[model samples]
Target: MVPMMMLAAIMSPSAQAQPAAATIESRAREVVALLGGTGDYDATFAPSFRTAVPRARFDAIAAQLQQALGKPTGVAAIEATGPWAAQIRIAYDGGTLNADLTLDPGGSHQIIGLLAKGAEPRGPAAQTLDAVVEQLAAQNGTSVFALARLGDGSPRLEKARNATTPIAIGSAFKLVILAELVRSIEAGERKWSDVVTLDGSALPGGGYAQQPKGTQIALRELAERMISVSDNSATDILLFHLGRAKVEAMLPVVGFTDGGVRNVPFLGALEVFKLKGVDGGALGTRYLAMDAKARRAFLDGPVRDTPIAAIPRDLFQNGKPLRIVELEWFASPNDLIRAMDWLRRHMDGTAGAELRAILSKNPGLPDATKHWRYVGYKGGSEPGVLTMTFLLQAGNGAWYALTAGINDPARDVDTLKFTGLMNRALDLAAPR
Candidate 1:
């Protein structure tokens, strides 16, 4: 988790200074009421608003808001900034919601914009830890280590089911690189503004592929891209700069030393594809047999420029005769949360702020703010593996680390099922 000192205070609308229209608050309340009562809510929208958000989409957003915040009780506060713009706080059966609503320009009361602001309550969570554990057990071949604490205190709920065992964590391993960079910055070794040159590497996604070579990007930008979008080339650049030894040493530095997760010769996106493309499915055996130096030689030698296009698509599916356990980066749920704790404890000033800002850039789910005062999340997914980890702060100023991973060598872990489950777990663990 990024340190609290790094996060900037979220700005609220000025209440007393701005002059508000007489009907502004009532208009906002009417909009909420129309959503609850239904009929053709789209009829209230301006032409542009209707074009941007169709009736079905508007209906979906309304349903989600109701599910997340419950029935709208009343408007608690309102600050109209313009003839159309108004900031409001609404009370609901679930909790209080902060929103910004804009009425259409002209004479129509059509809603131009309706955005939920700040954090709202997720109603009440499950009372007992057993209920959460039961849900975890229901999913086969899944492991989770979830512990929520109150402002750096002891865990309120710490439950581990096969949590000590390590599994392939996909992009979640990027956190290690982030942690190492912070350590370097704090030690006077590197500055966040330091710039580095980019060499050619065929990264997996379109995120970084379009950038020209010799781009002379700063370290901070690279780190942000790596974490926020899981940019492959950005990660490889950092990996090459840090070298294999420093990354390997990170396992023990962050307290992941119980042999649950291995530390040496980390794989970049290209290298991962190379391993998956090996003939006769012997990639894991071939790579595991070599020492760190030999592995480095192979990575640079044959697979250095391996492009994403070269790898077979079927190789990614479940039961493809590949050894994901040995081939990919591994970490247990417990190991990840421990590292999150370390990051939280060490975050300071600019470096911490950079990481926190990057984390908050994730286009979040609609109900995300309802449960957390703030959330820093990074998720990793592939064919047979899925992981979601969060560093959270509650409305009452408590902190939490909630992590879950699902693996199925037999088939792909259902993405929606696991994601929904983890979302519920996060809501359940929110500070009361």
Candidate 2:
């Protein structure tokens, strides 16, 4: 819910000290121009904004915006809220939206924050956060989301749907590996620069997978690739070097609190692909049917040695999702929130800056980044599942964590639709 304080207008008729009304208005107009697809980042946005949100990202956002809003006919003159801020009205053909612009006082007065808030007849329907939760849960398949404010004490779950039950989260499990890597580094057991040899079990959709069999890669580079691109090879390599037992041990510390019992004998990316991505999930079914002890032995035996090319490709390409559930790594939205907050607590200042940087590497989708000062994100998906979780820091210095996901056993989850809904939640959940 957007509190009354957030609705506390971003305006000041007279207060002084920052930029002139004319300068603020001009910068605000430049923001509109960028949204209209005619302005460049270096000229209109602050250094920090440019760094946090890249040009290509902004371009993509603008394209999506233009596609939705039609042509940006004009922008109203902005009112200077302070030396560094203003709220402007932006008019589009289909409808209209408002933008809150913030400028930097240090050197060139470029915009640091550009929050585009447009409450359609649709979302932010001037509605509560629960509305979005209900909508997500009401989707075709089982949809879930957990919203919370991160703090020193226990997190207050502001909204939730199926947030306690663990659900399949394809690649987001990489966060577990990342947390374990950080723990190992802090324990002086490993260094980010440590090099490891790569085995030949490569998967589709990863650059590292294309490298030579014995190629050497640094731990830091592997992590970056694993997260930024969802590099299956990089993730497997890290899991191999860190040891499954250690990574599994760190799961509860990061948020799986099940003591790794549920995910016992953790399966690597190669094993997952061999089982779930092939045989119409027959292999996964057989593997998942075993007990923990038997499962471990199975992984150590046939599952580990089976090659990805052992089957005819495209057997499952008819667009049907896999039937395996317990085979993939699983977590609830609240569990992911706990994991994100755990990372945030450990990464204070330089203590965990590099680690935090890894989380902030992609920021996933930019729809939420504009409203928050810091956006650290991780998203996962397969044919039947799509999950996105974020660690957002508001301008008021308050921190928030949220995870939204859709799980359908029969169909391909709609990415764009889920993303639009998730972005709406961010817009409404954020402070104005």
Candidate 3:
């Protein structure tokens, strides 16, 4: 999760440093034009802004905005202005966009913060929940599942097209870790603040892995990375320290065993990467033939022994193929929803609030928040797979959980398309 102070820095107005309204307005317009691709980043950005947001990243952001909301038609004059910052309403081809910009000091002011709100849903409602989900599934040509319950704990909607069928759901399996960690903490088995160090098995991903080896980290921070940033190294550190066997046992304990789908056994990011190093068919045959005990031993033996560096840095670089449907983590949409609900029930008081806070660290579905009083999100994606699970509380004090995943065995799923659909699905279910 981003440090709370960083957000504070962005939102906190500087004392006696507020720029004039005219300056804020011009800078806001210029930054929006840069993001809309009509202006060049190098020519328009402040020195610090240019350094922080390179030309390529700026271009990618502009392209994404174009793809997601279409070309920017116009931006309204500044609606709100703060010291070095301004907010504006923008009109796009598909929907409206709200943008906030913070500028540097002096006459050559540059944009230091350029944050954009996600596009809100704009479409006709379907007659039934099933029809809405099914239409999306048919349109995407993939499996889809969605379940939303009212604040009173009554079922508002439940629909699926092959949702129960297990598919690899990248980092969404981290939900199991977060839930189990909460349970362990409640039982006094582990403390969130306990300090731990990286091991040889530490693999590359987000957060601390980007740091040098042997960096000491707090357990609470590890959990934050797992949920908020989906950091792989943080996940492995927790799994290693918590014991994979315990997490394995907790799966069924959390109601994941009832689905009859085989619960994923002894798989972590590092182990999954190593598993891809061997013959795919042989690996499948050998793994499927193993009993539970054998699988555990296998993970502890050959899988654990594989060197971290031996695993390629890029798992998706053409030839380094992974068994997306079989070798990696697997969970049905129903299982994921149950996991979220299980976490909700187990997390209470300060512990619950802390977990939810970490989850809110990434407000992935901006439109969903329009209906929910609070929303917590965790999503996972890898080649050919994308999954998102949400724990939500409605404005009326109703609680609901929603999970959606899409997979294509032949190639990578269109990530932006799936994400847009997921946001739309939540918006459709928000009213109930």
Candidate 4:
């Protein structure tokens, strides 16, 4: 789980531009072939890698893995970092292992680095919170985790790791959006059935964005989609309706105390898409330099008119996760716990019930629902960010909140592996 750094021999800085799709594909094929003992080491690995781990040693290692994990299968996935490096998922008969793969940044595109890491641990690893934190801290650029029991007052921390440090939470910030909408409803300022129009910006699956621009939909449905599927278009509409200033204010009230200064003039989902999509992400490079005022001006001025079609066809595929750590939503695992507690405490009337339904619609971790009387979950991810938060009511009606987030900022973190770790954390925090 350590933050991956390329071997010093080719420690070249990555261009913000994306790596070519063909390069990723070819490198993946070569690595798998090499693992299977069918490809030549000299051809598959660069001289730097071969020099550090000799051809004989690499062959022996590959043989050892085959003995332990069975045959080397195809590359399951590749998460590219900028224009040079990628984290590759290699499938095997028993399970999977990850490879930190890098190509020479020089025009040659030679395989400059290759380091194979162990497959994810089974249920045997991380028996305690301290153990879990060790694993988490080792795995990402910054990892924040919090587990708390909720009561009438503040949440009680059972275990926490850098719980107050802000890290990008990706779409998990939709929780705040949901929170703000619920708060407004409780204050009689809004209603679940209130209608809003769609702007039809594209989202990853067909969202309201695919519908006609003039089409109207209920706020409840929008919130449901935003949380249940992490629907970006739906989130943008709600953010627009609520206004950024209002959502920004809701941050600390829910849990994130520094949201205003950290994320001034808040951003919508489409706005982020545009920022990362235009001019090969040159706009983001410029946008990153500004203060709150300048950023607001830039986003509103030229950035506003950036076309929807301007978003890359491979927006998430082979794309560098540009400026996500700085440009996206920021929250701590502690903040998420308090946010979940706030939503739990709000459940006294219709607004409360609606909030529960929206948050519970997905359960993010569906199998765990059997362990609690009630389970409401919302999670989020991008290329290099993964965050999950859960609100649970135990069989004894005791309430608890569990959250974990990993921000790599270099390559994508493995979703299955992180979820496995969080699953263990939940079992420890609230055993069946």
C-alpha RMSD by candidate, in order: 9.5, 11.0, 5.9, 13.0
lDDT of 4: 0.74
lDDT against the true structure, each candidate: 0.65, 0.72, 0.66, 0.74
Residue-by-residue lDDT tens digits, candidate 3, 1-432: 010101113444544344446666776666667667677666566554554345665576567667777887776546554566555666778766665566664556655556553453345545566665765576443566767563434334465666566777788888888877888888887787888876545564545665665778998998987886567878988887888778877887665653333655757877776677544345445766788789878878876765666664434534222567567777777777777777777657447777778777766654667777888888877667778888888777767888887777776565545656676667766656
Residue 216, candidate 2: Cα error in Å is 1.5
Q: Compared to the true structure, candidate 3 yields what TM-score? A: 0.73
Ranking of candidates on lDDT, top first: 4, 2, 3, 1
Pairwise TM-score winner, candidates 2 and 4 = 4
Question: Each model's TM-score?
Answer: 0.67, 0.70, 0.73, 0.71
lDDT preference between candidates 1 and 3, better one: 3
Global lDDT of model 1 = 0.65
Regions of candidate 4 where Cα sits further than 4 Å from its true position:
1-92, 95-125, 199-206, 258-260
How far does residue 430 in candidate 2 sit from its true spot (Å)? 1.5
- Rate residue 51 of model 4 by lDDT: 47
Clashing pairs in 3: 18-83, 46-110, 151-398, 151-399
lDDT of 1 by residue, 140-200 (tens): 6665656656345434446666666787787888888888888888778899899877676
- Colliding pairs, model 4: 1-138, 1-139
